[model samples]
Target: MVEFERLANEKASEYAYRYLKKNIVGLGFAPNSKICESDIAKKLGLSRTPVREALLELVKNKLVVVYPQRGSFVSKIDYDLVEESRFVRLVLEKAIIDIVCDKPDNRFLEKLEINIRNQKYYLDKENKMNLMQLDNEFHKILFEMANKLQTHELVESISGHFDRLRNLSINTIKDIKTVSDHEKIFEAIKSCDSVKAKELMEIHLSRHKFEEKILREKYSDYFD
Candidate 1:
């Protein structure tokens, strides 16, 4: 059964949307699986209306598909769309790294260090979910420091497929290289090496391509 906790001051639809999205991205609601509105509403203790609205929002994000005379289903992982999303994210991340290196704020740099430390902690615990959250927070902090939060939001808004792919990679591949990549990227940024930082960011963002075949072979049904 799916569980949800409503946040104070958050609308029912908004809360439902967030909870549903997290599960979808985490593969809790497996790709191409039917999403029963009434079932979800009952589990979440919400009315069908909010759950319906939440599904509509997910439809806009391309994380869910709706068909006439049928019902909603989790969208299959579209590798092409994932690649496109990665490309856009790479551009934005490189730009942000450039900005970060140009200024190299000590405060934010320390924050990155703490985040990486936390990532290592979570990785040791083999908690992929927390590690994934830390991974995102590391990049989010970079965007915040670079005053590119809106750009980060844009990347995230279109990164549903890529996000799902990443979640799968973290869960299945058992790769710890991501944390190393973050450490190296931090070093480049700390030393104000714009070129090195951008190069590292490109390599970091491009890792999904290398893992694509393996992931597809193992989770064939999850892909489109």
Candidate 2:
């Protein structure tokens, strides 16, 4: 893996957190891989203090495992946590959609459209990561328009475990399902069909059941 370099003048802990989190979530650092603080600090041209703090933050997020007098490593995919995140996301998104249905904003609709356009652009180019980023932006826009940005942030804070699965399988259900589902959700919102939009959101996010199971099996080594 290529060593990541941070921008000049940034705090080491935050930079390390972002750096390590990206690698872990993007599958650059395989699950259960040893996280040598000394090695990473050396690679990043930093000292162990900031790296240690960063790893502790990751530990609280369940993204890193630390064993006293042993070592630290990346945490494996925990299905129970994924299910919990799914529940949390479903509830918050459903509530948000219901609120949005009361009065949909044209500017928000335009934002979602632009995001979809970018999704298609990156999808056509076979850029899975970029497409997934747009997918996230679409939902972020949804919550923003619904005036529930804080709720969305709260959901995201606890979704690292589930996002690992989503990122792993983004290519599996990219265009055929994910983007199409977003389009359908948009149509429902435009028509002011709150019920339909909420149901579709449930289906869209919950549709990953089978895919997630398959990913867990295929990447057995990556799961607890």
Extract clashing residue pairs from model 1. none
Give all candidate RMSDs, comma-separated: 1.3, 2.2
1-224: candidate 2 lDDT, tens digit per residue: 42566878889998888889888887778899999999889888889999999999999999999988989999998989989999999899988888888899999999999988887777766658887678889999989998888988898889888888887778555445778889999999999998999899999887668687677667889888
TM-score, one value per model: 0.96, 0.90
lDDT of 1 by residue, 131-200 (tens): 8899999999999999889988898899999999998888877664789999999999999998998899
At residue 92, give the lDDT of candidate 2: 90
TM-score of candidate 1 versus the correct structure, residues matched by position: 0.96
Model 2, CA-based lDDT: 0.85
Residue 211 lDDT in model 2? 85
Regions more than 4 Å wrong, model 2:
1-10, 172-176
